[model samples]
Target: MNNTKDFAKSSWIALVLIVLLNSCGSAVKSTPPPLRSQAEVVSVGQDKVEDSVEKKLENVKIGDAQAYYYYQLAVLSLASGNIEEAVDSFYNAIKLDDKSPFLHTELGKALARKGDLSKAKEACEKALGLDPSYLPARTLLAAVYSGLNEKEEAIKEYEKIIELNPREVQPYILLASLYKERKEYDKALGVLNRWIGRHQNSEVGFYHMGQIYLEMKDYEQAARSFEKAIEENGDFIQGYSALGALYENQKQYQKAAETYERALKVLGDDPRVLDRLLRIYTQLKDYNKALAYAEKLKDMSPEDEEIDVDIGVIYYESKQYGEAEKLFRGYLDEHPENIEVRAYLAATLEENQKYDEALKEWEKVLEQDPKSFDTRIRIGMLLSEQGKHDQAIKMFEKTLELFPDRIRSYILLGASYNQAKRYEEGLQVLQKGLAVNEKDPALLATLNFHIGVSLERLGRFEEALTTFKKVVELDDKHSNAHNYIGYMLAEKGIRLDEALVEIQKALELEPDNGAYIDSLGWVYYQKGMIDEAIRELERAVSLIDDDPVIHEHLGDAYTKKGLFQKAVSAYEKSMKLKPENEEQVQKKLEEARVKLKSQITTHTTGR
Candidate 1:
């Protein structure tokens, strides 16, 4: 409903009546108010709000012309969002008509909006004084008391409101909300129970009750209440929303997805529910369902251009970066002001290996939102990926300068320094990060692990081992630290037995980790168990066929077993996989070939 126009038109009757009564000139013709104005085309706009103001407007009657005119202006100003002017008009209307409770209540509302809680309280009190049973005044007074942190007063007002009119559902809901806030769970439930008994199809009470149970950690009761909420009112989207959120919080993703789909069965693919479903599916990595929902949402809400961004994100997550990039670019062409979609485009470009294009987009994003922490991190990481270690280090330093409290920035800057082989700087940076989040074990483990890496690269073996041990102590489940400790022990080859135990423990932590498996194979090889080493290394190779280190380990095992032909094949495969020590691999390949030829000659001669 056009509330401003309707209220303004409603006052026309009083205006004409006053003008005709006190006219100083010839009489003017007056038309009667119609039962249905032209604006009553259909049901009012319930697409957003639940109720229409038409019902409330029926009681609005003004006898004074000047007061009525000021009242009309105030309502019009309120709708136009001119709060100051509306407040002034409301004040003028109240002065001209002090007995009208509606005027006082409206003034109180306007004052509350202006953050003048004291005066608002006074106005609401004045309205209640004029009419003891004025429910609007009581409601406004309750809200004002709540705003002033006078909870007991607010509770009294809501209770009196319910006592005055028990059939009114709003007072019950508001009163229950007050009880819920005070953690009076039983009282809140009792109020809601009364509310449910009094009002038909009032799912809101049950939904609020579900929230209360959820907050109290009563999962069983919460689920039942949510179910009852949805069952009570088929159109209550909040009920389904609460159910979906509850299931997700419990990690019952399948049930959450089912609840989201059930909303469609009742609401027929409401855009709000579909949007939630699209996000939930995306989070679950169910790309097929996510894409399908995105398409349906697009078709349903063609005017919601932001749906294009959602579709692009789905394509991006599914690793169809080409499609994502195309879609994002198309959207940006029409709406270049969309910085968020441009960020998606940058990510897609990075995935597609269009580094230069990605860099440009990141630069544009940084220009638009200079304080975006993640964008700064991404730009630095991209620079590091391109081997521009100095530039990456500088970018990360700037990020640290801007956001000193962000622990991740310190980690990133440290990583860049470590990549540049500046071990001291990397160590110092990690230590700085450790100073703050000293109590967060996960963060400590991360910083200590990176520090350990820097120490290992600096040839500080014993210190690095000690740091890794510290990391394990901080977080025993940290598989990376376990693998590092095991790999380092195996490489030293002094404590072969201890190395074997460590590597086995690492494999126990992450059974499918190819690097840990390779460490195990290396431990076996150092112990002269060539056959065992070969088996483990071959398994590691199968697990991570692209790893050069695993292939090289298999080659070494084959050489130890004197299977020169197989050894030659393994070394050639290692070389093909691009081992870092290419020259060493080439020398090993030559030696393996010579050994194979010698073996072949000896076998033939012996035959």
Candidate 2:
């Protein structure tokens, strides 16, 4: 055995964040165990070791004196987690007092704790033979059987325990849990129902039933049972949390928040309840409440630096990018090597349009976690966002090379090629993605959409239209495909009525989409609805003012209405924005200027 001095140096536990294993991957509240210094534990443990053996008094009728001494040492060993020594001492105690059922049961418990289940079962059986109604021995035997995966024997023992002690809570709970583990939900429910029949107001039993129903995916029954449990006990924390979680799973944030609030009303500032409120409020975009809970939790556990990351995330989600940036920087100052916090800082900087600074942060994260696929993807996206399409394409192609099974890299690289107008390369990559993701309707739709765009830019109009139609067949609500088809037909001045219908459908799906609105305006212009064309085109410009194409469309609409001065102004604005067809736009601008001059001259002569 190691010296007690070593034991005195390794007892204190450390605290850290508990990242939830939820879809959101959000950090939730966690607290550390109360600090126990090795010195304190050793000091207390030394006393326990020294004084555990009882003094054999004068005629006290204590079972064999040596057995009592060994029993005390066994208990002390067990408490100190010295399982092997505890088992040895327990067996020693039992050998001295062969008929003592308590000693036999204690030995069984030690064996069970040491994971020697077969021996533990034998010892427990010996104890039960000494006293047939010995509850502790029977309980140990049942647990040993369970540990050995002998569910049927465990169930029989539990049934005997329930028959022997019908009013006890644990036997029923244990039996139902065994059945639940085996997915025998009906059996689990039966055990709970049997308990509820005898003890109608058993909140715990009802809660167990609700848990079983939840596993069965009988959500309505789960809710009813949970509600019933809460009605039976207003202070049932488990009931409130479970019901709130159910509502959250259903995306009913308001009702979930209300249930958590009710829990808080009854249970005060319980950490579990507080943490859940933080998550719920964050999801609801109730940043104020989320921050309040975060601050409160920080106050409760000042030593934990993990909460700062979560608080920073809350700010990021709230779109207070400046505040989020500041928080992340401050956290990184203390935890300079924390890749996760640095990544957040990068994202915050990106959202604030500080692209260069964001790139530096992402570079730092990538250097720290070189193999991180997500980090690599983010860096590639940042490059693309800055119109460094070739660099982005190279990065994504490398990502595909490094992680060939990653479908996202193929999609992103294909999109990057299309953005760079490398249409043939984009088509090839997109087709490869489709080949690999044949069964994924959603990915197939996305890849087909990109292929259609490439074909459209390549002037393969019929192929592009067919591909776009295929995207809509895969996903009827694909607004991009609808808009593409509409704009293609309108651009060709053919099927104006069908173009209007397609654009209107796209607008129906995404009413505020500036691109779709511009498509609608162009379709209207094709149909000779010049006034309506101007209205929709102007609305598109208002929504996305930097779009040179929308400006050019507006200029065309003005010229068609013979508003020569307005047409000249719109064309000049389009020229300033550096439209794709610069020479064509310059020609339009010159023509509009000549028309404006002629109109002024005609008006003056008429005056």
* Best-fitting candidate, scored by lDDT: 2
Candidate 2 per-residue lDDT over residues 1-607, each given as its tens digit: 6655223213210000000001111221111112245455445544443344343122224379998788777767766778799888878877888898777876775665455668878988998899988777787777677766678998999899888877766678779988998999999989988887887567788788888888889989998988988998887777887899899998999899999989999988887888889998999999999999998888988887788888999999999999888889988999999998999999999999999999999989989988788988999999998999988998898888887766677788888998888989998987787657357777778888998998999999999999999999999899999999999999999999999899999999999999999999999898999999999999999899988888899999999999988898888888999988999999999999999999999999985
lDDT values of the candidates?
Answer: 0.80, 0.81
lDDT of 1 by residue, 33-109 (tens): 12244234111211111232232234468777799888777766655557699889988998899999878987886
lDDT score at residue 418, model 1, on the 0-100 scale: 97
Query: Candidate 1, residue 350: CA error in Å?
Result: 2.4
TM-score for candidate 1, residues paired by index: 0.75
Clash number by candidate, in order: 0, 0
Predict model 1's lDDT versus the native: 0.80
